[model samples]
Target: MADLDHSSDDTSVDSREESSQDSKLEFSEDEETLVALMYNLIGERWSLIAGRIPGRTAEEIEKYWTSRYSTVSE
Candidate 1:
């Protein structure tokens, strides 16, 4: 019988799952509206827009916008 090593593959899959879970943040309707307003006013300057949103970073805001609103708006 031959044994195959799958520990490395399992670790990589777990890390990817963790990252995906971390990225799945939820925004309230008010927050979404505010983000949309800021996006419309300032364009894609995520850093600048992030300042207006409390508890959210530029990267998070940018990711959310790109994933949720970019296609809809365009």
Candidate 2:
């Protein structure tokens, strides 16, 4: 019987994380307002809300929202 390799490649994951870490997104005042409004209206559906923003991704938005709002709410 031949052995199948089940190990997962983590290089892509590491590269993605590294890229995201390196690329810091600066949200404008308008973008901040939009994100807040959309978050309030949609409630944590970051991907859907991200579509409304031009240069932002769901992960970035989610991270931003969490860092900015999560602690204040608690």
Top candidate by lDDT:
2
Candidate 2 lDDT score relative to the true structure? 0.81
TM-score of each: 0.63, 0.64
Writing each residue's lDDT as its tens digit, candidate 2 over 1-74 gives 12222223466677887887656356789989999999889999999989999878899899888877776653
Model 1 steric clash pairs: none
Relative to the unseen true structure, what is the C-alpha lDDT of residue 8 in candidate 2, on a scale of 0 to 100?
A: 36
Please give the RMSD to the true structure for each candidate, in Å: 4.7, 5.2
Query: lDDT of each prediction vs. the true structure?
Result: 0.80, 0.81
Q: Which consecutive 10 residues in model 2 have the weakest lDDT in total?
A: 1-10
